[model samples]
Target: MSSMTKIADIEAEIARTQKNKATMAHLCALKARLAQLKRDLIASETKKGGPKGDGFDVQKTGDARIGFIGFPSVGKSTLLNKMTDTFSEVAAYEFTTLTCVPGIVAYRGAKLQMLDLPGIIEGAKDGKGRGRQVIAVARTCSLILIVLDVAKPLQHKLIIERELDGFGIRLNQEPPNIVLKKKDRGGMNIASTCPLTQLDADTIKTILSEYRINNCDIMFKGDYNADQLIDVIEGNRVYIPAVYVLNKIDQISIEELDIVARIPHNCPISAHHDWNLDGLLECIWDHLNFVRLYTKPRGQVPDYNEPVILKKTPQPTVESFCSRIHRQMMKKFKYAWVWGSSVKHQPQRVGKDHLLDDEDVLQIVKKV
Candidate 1:
């Protein structure tokens, strides 16, 4: 049978299975099998030239990339037009924006690339409505802005989360604090630093066994469950921060808007009326966690007009800063003089390993 067919059968069986201690092992194995099948289906489709169309292959530019994802006619085009001043075809009907539209916005001295992706429908992760293609592009983004209509936000939000989850995209989450290392002779050695309330010995073994992992060392640094274990084992998941942009707030009442705003990591706005867009932009900036650094010459003043942008991850250090400016600069590397919150003195001389803070001034001192 085809992979999709097998997946469907397993899913049906899983849904029918009872949830209890006795059935936990079976359920874990079933879920792992389902995940593997889906991965295989996507891999096979990729080998056969997966979804392709015009405007799908957008060239990535700017300090960071943000993709606008939601169902059709949710004010995505209007948001893009207003925020980035880029023209995206807007209309009253659904699926009006059928292709990926790219726009650039300069925020806090950092240029962010915004993409108005095609409307994603339910069953998107299952490759329905060419969603596989749309989400594939989304996976490349540093942040995903899930634009939703203020009306019926919760239902659509859950569906979109599920779709992204199925595609191995973990939204607003960090990678599970779990590690798996293969060993030749030793059998499955499982260890946990904290009390794992959701996962037991049997469940862990069942999940590992499903992947034919006979010998391995598993360590859980934090309390996690079976699904997290599976995600770690799969090793294909991408953890991305997402903001739910509740657009068309002008149509909703004040009380209704208050409830919508209560949703965690959400920003309510009316794209057409240009209401509360500043708040949305600020929310996006915070989620992005971009650090801006200025370069200082030996004698000249620091240039603030064009600042270097770095991600908060991997720890932005002077070494990375040098590499960002020029790959060859590291060869003659010595140290950097800093003037910002990262240092105590006005311009403390620090080594390349020194971590940099936002808006910090850096002046590299190379070897003689």
Candidate 2:
């Protein structure tokens, strides 16, 4: 039978069992099984490039992708809708979002794309209720945003952390920023004792600096031991750089906000109230090391006055940088003229083998 028809039948059975405890238990179990089947169907459809399924291929488009992850009903969808132009369904129910929704958030004339993935549940990695599928989506993203309900119990928060671990999605590297939702709700003050909140900024900076210097050009080939893997990917390289955004600040008190602010790298905001969005945007850019660079006309003299951001990458060769501008630029079979600290002459021409450094300006003269 069709999924809709099956759901209808299950609903009818559930309604009929309202007075019978034994029948209700059986129907509820069946309903849960049916829901799992529905989720599997959705996952299969998405993998095959169908409309009903979430478009996973959207990430391959070279957009700076961010993934949203957390347990059910943590306001991830609400934050996604507020940050991007997407109209994702926002409800208090768990697992309301089954498919990933990709949306674009424009900031300061640049567009950053983010993905709102399905909610993760306990034991998600081992084929538990859309857990495996969600982890697959998270693997492809450049950044992961881990949303947490601050009002929820500590045990609940730890459940999410364990789920991430179960899926082998590393949070410490490209580690997801903890977005503490419902900060306004009066609850047990978890922020003060939060392990993440207790992290010192200076210590974080020191660790990041050491990480950059040591692993600047290191590349892993095949599967290594877990100890080696941990040593290699535990820092910023494997993990997308992240900044904490304490969402739902309008619901919290000043004292609470102050405690949250004291956290090493927290940015408070109210996604529902549309507060501090710009600050969040700025933080995202800063964390991502994203720089805006405008293109200039071929014949027109290059403007040295306007600043163009040259993003730092493990490999910043001419070939890689040129490909970013346009694949055709690389295919056109021409050399690039480098102008900056590397060359003494004005607009010094360099071959395709040239390596570009941060803030180095270039004028590519292609062979049409």
Candidate 3:
């Protein structure tokens, strides 16, 4: 059978199989097998020269990137045009925006690059409708704006999410706290800090065996399922925040809008009519989790016109801040005086490793 056929058969079996202690090992092995098959298929496609055409090579710009992903003509282009004031050629027909269109949105003193990617279709992860190319760009984004038509929001949302999930994009999720280290002589030692509720030793061993991992030390800090463990083993998954942009809200009633708004991490807006666009921008800002830092010169006041934007993840430090300003700034740096919630005292003296909070004023004191 073909790889796709095998994958389909495995999925069918996995779905039909009942959940119980007796079948957990079997289910885990099947999932691992399915993952390996997909990996092989991707590798083969890569060898055959994957999608690289159609102006998909968008230059990374601005502080961070937010990608608009959905089915064709779902107001992605319109939303991009409205938010960034960049023309993406919106139309009523499908597939109007073919290439990756990049636009910059200046919000709250930070510039965010917004990408209007080509619409993705079903089986996108399998390279349908230039889906791989679109998803490839989406993976680079710090946040994914899953634009959906408010009429059929849930239906399209599920399909688009499936596509992204298949491509190893875990939206609004943290990486599984499972570590697998390969050692020559360990002979497959498995340990867990918490109780293994979703996984057992048998299931874990089955999954590991499918990967041909003979000797390794595996540590599970949380009760993760088989798929999460597989993802951990794959080590290529990206945890990105996402917001479901339910566009064309003008067509829906207030009751419908109220129901749609109840969905977690969603924003209802009318891209064509420019309604609730502010709410969408606010949602984007919240999901981006950006840290703004102001630079205070030696004698002058802190420059608030333009603040340094940093990702809230990895928790920005003084050393990183110095590096952001200039590579050589750290060389002449002695210490910094920070004024923010991160410091106990007002404008406390701190070293390079001190972690900075949002809206912090930093004044670097270089060695004389």
Candidate 4:
């Protein structure tokens, strides 16, 4: 029998055996067999790719991909190393990380992929010192983290800012979160005294009004905390998410930690000391807004526990996501069985337009 037929038989048997105490154990065994069959069917279909399950599920890509950019020696490599298990060379000297290194940051049960691009300096977009390559990397990333060395002179910051503007990469809707690294260096604490959270509206406007952002359609992967900055960079329409890491905190005092906390949408961590790293990961997961769900054949009661993560900015529809599972599934899709927050009653069939909320189990039925 086809998978659908087997599911229907199981459901019918479950109803008939619901009141028979002597057969309850057998009924449960049948249910387990039905669940396994459904799983096997889904796996086979998914393997077909594109609608047919030939490896076309978009959810397989994991959470959003984010890119990191900043001036050399701003602790970008160190932060990346701490957040992800991958070891990119972390040196005290400038320009240590020459290429982009991608790593996964696990947060609150979700995994967010972060990319550490080569350090960018003033005039990078104009092909000065690998600026072109950095810009190329930025173009493909869903979100960009601009690392700033607060210990450096104001002139250095301006040079980096001017180069970004010169490259026409400043998305004016949301400004990048400026991560101040090495706060303990030379006993300098610029951000501590002049907190980013304390910046007035005029100051923020003046800071971002110059750049002529060229790419408007790019989508960045980050947590919701970065909404403000992403909106500024992408013209208020695009949602770019990011998490701010105040690295080298071990060298600083509790007073410094308090100051870092005060900064808007910031997470403090000491890569060397491994302090508050879990908190940072939690923040990253919250930012991504990911949800988990499971799929099975129609007419079979849905399983709630075995779910796969589906990364989405906002929740998507069952039909739309079914297409992501397999292109052929989309073509043959007749209806869906849904279970979640949006469903008002017991498991039931839904039309193609039925919207799906987070953690909503789905069993898509298609006509052969």
TM, every model: 0.98, 0.59, 0.96, 0.57
Worst 10 residues of 4 by lDDT: 51-60
lDDT of 4: 0.57
Q: Which of 3 and 4 is ahead in TM-score?
A: 3
Runs in model 2 deviating more than 4 A are: 1-59, 108-110, 152-157, 172-238, 261-265, 301-311, 326-335, 338-360
Q: lDDT, candidate 2, residue 322? A: 72
Superior by lDDT: candidate 2 or candidate 4: 2
For model 2, what is the alpha-carbon lDDT of residue 151? Answer: 49
Clashing residue pairs, candidate 1? none
lDDT of each residue in 1-368, candidate 3, tens digit only: 89999999999999999988898899889999988888888778878886588678888988889999999989999888888778999777999988999999999999899999999999999989899889878889999999999999989989999999988899999999998998877688999999988887878888998998989999999989999999998888899999999999889899988987777899888989999899998989999999999999988999998999888889999999999999999999999999999999998999999999999999999999
Task: Please give the CA lDDT of all the candidate structures.
Answer: 0.92, 0.59, 0.91, 0.57
**lDDT of candidate 3 vs native?**
0.91
> Candidate 1 lDDT, tens digit per residue, 138-177?
9999999999999989999999998999999999999999
Worst 10 residues of 3 by lDDT: 46-55
Candidate 4 per-residue C-alpha lDDT over 1-368 given as tens digits, one digit per residue, 9 for 90 to 100: 78767866886887877545455345545544544454455455446532221211112134567677677887788878877888889887888987767788655344567777777766564346776556555655555565544333245545755555433344323444443232222432223223244233333332232222222222222222222432333342333554555666666678756755564556666656777768776666666556666776555666654455655645677766776676677788888877778689757679888877777788777687
Error of 4 at 328 (Å): 2.2
| Ranking of models by lDDT | 1, 3, 2, 4
Model 3: number of clashes? 0
Sort by TM-score, top down from the best: 1, 3, 2, 4
